[model samples]
Target chain A: MKNLLKHHETYVLLVIIIFSAIITVINPRFLTLENFFDVVKSYSFIGILAVGVTFVLISGGIDISFTAVATVAQYVMAVMIIRYGGNIFTAFLLAAAVGISLGLINATLIYFFNIPTIITTIATLNIYYGILIVISGGKWIYALPGWFRAFADIRLFTLCTDEGIKYGLSIITSIWILVVIIAWVILRYTKLGRGIYAMGGSMNAARRAGFNIFRTQMFVYSFTGLMAGLAGLVQALLVQTVAPNSIVGKELDVIAAVVLGGASLAGGVGTLFGTILGVTLIAIMSNGMTLMRVSSFWYNVFIGLIIILSVAFSAYQRRTKAKRAIAVEVE
Target chain B: MRSRHSELIILGCITTAIFALMWVFNPNQFLRIGNLQNMAFQLPELGLLSLAMMVTMLTGGINLSIIATANLSGIVTALILTAMINPDAPPPGSGGIIILAICAGLLTAMLIGLLNGILVAVIDVSPILATLGMMILVNGLTIVITKGYVISGLPNAVRFIGNGVVLGIPMGTIIFALCAGIMALILNLTVLGFNIYMVGSNPTASNFAGVNNTAVLIKTYIISGLYAGIAAMIMISRFNSAKAGYGESYLLVTILASVLGGTSAAGGFGKVSGLVMSLIILQIASSGFNLLGVSAFLTIAFWGFIIILVMVVNFISAKVLERKAA
Candidate 1:
């Protein structure tokens, strides 16, 4: 038990349980299985982005452009559906392709130019978002086809309770989980994954070790783009509309969640399980706030504070660990 | 420094070229007095925000919360102004109230800035994450306080700051110029300014040289926050209202302007004159776009493109300089 406590994930799990327990005590409605599923389903989109972003962060880069890329891809998907009578499969394929291309734009620019990743991505974010707005005439697409909206209605399991029937699982949630598992395996087993860690840890060392920096960066960004595209589709289907402006600025939330899950912004660290916990914590906080009838604005305030505190706590942990290691070496 | 001067010249050329092109396309309207005045008025808010961005960038950091800080300060001042004034009274003797409100608003901004400085300098959080948190926190606080409603019917003083003109020049522009001039003096002459550049250039080296790096960083962010406060004053008065989400789009443009003005993202390099020129170039481009019936949204894409273009130009110039040296 004490050994398990040494893991950051275990501590995160404990925090989640305690937080949920407190919220449940205050508002029992939050404890319902229905609400649990709702939280998981609602956060699934962010979860998918977080999964890909974990790779980028671990590889020692950041991509603020994913949200913009996702926005453009989703807009295209919507346009094709409503304007051109495109099928679901065609829309997904096209969106994924567009997303990959957009991701390549970011990867190639950063790789070739050797510019700072943050500035490069910020520039791309604006360009992609602005282009989408101009192309779409800044109009919201509302009339999505019925099939697309209802595309993910498959329930993994259903439970009948005294109150009502509730689905224990959803296809959307399953997709998120599947991605997480796949990403976990890739990070743990693949050479490219290990290469990413080496690159992020030290660029010169990684290059000296014969790790291809350009290819690794290209793969990292493209992977993020691909995930953003898939998440965008899920978001549109879930909401039944595509508001171009809505998705552009939420990259902060994803970054915050990834960082909160024990990922260092400085790179060379992060995990799939840690990211899941982070996403869940954020989702639960929002859900709890809504359930408590608190003003939504306060929600952002709390999130901001939580992000600062979480990052600070982790930094402190790393510092103490370093100090302990030094003390042992001295002895 | 040579590169900085060349960047400024390049920006000047770009601005003039755009102006000439616009004048040729529509000379009468583009050079009309009314349009010129309007452009002067439009330049300051973005100019001030960009200035604020440059200050932090000089320390090799960024304050993403500038827009949010501006909004929150404006909202605080608005709340004070509206709460103190009797609704039935028309612009009553409330000069003192206006002064008090402005102070409160500026104080609020400074406090927020101090929090950001502490987080980044003391707690050692990444500047991006720290400022991003502050942005969201303050934005949320502003929204909660205002209930997502716009606060209007500001005092006459706001009109003077926002829209008033003296000797045919806009008050906002005057304020921006004064602030920019003061900032230039500080950067060029003050010890703090020298420290900022040194720390930004190389923190470890500066520390070894006995420079107070943390103090410099804290001071830099505080100055940035104070600039945001000043900008809030201009913005609130100009719009005759305040809201939490107003100027939501200015954040990116401010960064764009700063970068275009020759502020390096990796830090230790920027110029006030360069930033001023960049602001003029963007403002003219935007005004020209409006005149040409181009979608205003497209300008954002242009701004993004311009950053990349400037970087490319800088890269080429650096390469040429290297070859010449070799």
Candidate 2:
């Protein structure tokens, strides 16, 4: 129990539980099974994107172009299916390829040029988004194929509500959970994951220790792109349409959630469990705001405040931990 | 030769070439005084925002909250004016209330800057995350107060600052030039400015040299906020309204301008003259594209492309210089 308490994820988990309890008390409807599933479903997209970003952040790099990559890849998938009459499998395959291709572009720039990841991604985001808009002529793809819509409806279970019915679990949620588990396992058990963490710890040291920086960066960014691509498809399917401009600005939410969940921007830190809890906390915050009849404008205000506070708290914790280590050394 | 002046020379050459091309292709539209005046009027808003970005970048920090600060300040000033004047009546002609409103807005921006500075300098939060949070917070507050509606109908005194011309030049352009001059003076002549460069180049060395790093950073951000306030005033007057969501696309462009102007994101480098030339180059390029009947969206892509090109050139030049030295 003490060991568990020592972990950063525990505190985040505690916050989520406390927030959920308070919101449930304020609005009894918040505790309903439907609401739980609703939060899970909504955060699934962010959750999937966060999985990839978690790795990047842990690897001591940043990727803001994920949302753009996702948008373009999703658009490509949808356009191929709608225009070229491709199958669902072919569409997804092409989407992943596009995602990987874009991610590799970001990776290559950062790796070869030694430019900052944030700056490179910022430029590429504009390039990718601009090309997408020009090619599509800024048109909204509202009507999607019947099969595409049906893909999201692959339900694991259903619940009968007093009003009518509710979905208990769907493939979307399953994918979200599965991705988290995969990220967890990779970070904990894989050599590449350790190399990423090592690179974040100290680039020079990692290089001296025979860790391949280029390969690690490529894996990190490409993996993020692949997941963003998948998340893009899921998001489009959920919305039942594709508007190229709509999905481009939501990278902040993912970054904020990841940061709130204890992912350090300085790298060499972060965990899948903490990321999940962070996503849950953000999802509930928004959900609770809606339940309390608060204006949506306040949502951004709260999110900003929370991000500042949580990071401050974590910094404080690290300071105290460092002090304790120094005292031990003195003894 | 990979001299220090080479980038500037390259930038100059590009600007001249583009101007020559435009003069040849669309001489009538591109070289007309009326069109030049329009370009001058439009340049300052982005130019001021870019200056705000450049100041913060000097401290090796970024203030993503610039547009949000501008919007919030404008909204605050608009609210004050709206409360004073009758909703249905015509705007008052007196400039007194307008001055006060501008003061109030500038004060709000200063406070926001102080908060941002403290968050980054004192609390030791990453500048990007700190300013990013501030950006969202300020934007949300503005939306909540204005309820997503545009605050139209400002007094005429305010509009004059945006629309008024002085000796064949725009008042807005003049204001932008004055701000640039002041920034250049501060950077070149002031002790605080010297410390800013020292601190940015090496904070540890600056600290060892007894430089007040925290104070310099705080002051730098405050100046950035002040620039944003003036830009907001210009923006509000030009549009005859203020809103929470205006100029949402200026964030990245400001960064692009600063970088293209030779402002190193790594700190300890940049110049006002370079920035002016870069902004002009961009304005002409964008307008040139528009004249050719290209889509406006392509301009953004062009900005991104140019930044990459500049980075590549800078990288290659640095390498060549190193090899020559070796």
* RMSD for each of the candidates: 2.5, 2.5
Please list the residue runs of candidate 2 whose C-alpha ends up more than 4 Å from where it truly belongs after superposition. Answer: A1-6, A322-331, B1-3, B86-93
How high is the CA lDDT of each candidate model?
A: 0.86, 0.87
Q: A1-331, model 1: which lDDT tens digit per residue?
A: 8888656777678878988898898899999888889889888899999988888999989888999988998998888878777677887897788888999999988887776787788888988998889988889988888777677676798877776766678878888888888889888899899998998888888999999988999999999999999889878867778999889878877988887787776788888889999998889889998888877778988888877777666656667777788543211
Question: Residues B229-281, candidate 1, lDDT per residue (tens digit)?
Answer: 99999999988999988897888778888888888877898989999988988
Please state the error at residue A139 of candidate 1 in Å. 2.6
TM-score to native of every candidate shown: 0.95, 0.96
The digit string of per-residue lDDT tens for model 2 on A81-198 reads 8887866788779878999999999998888877778788888888899889988998999878888888878889888799787668877888788878887888889888899899
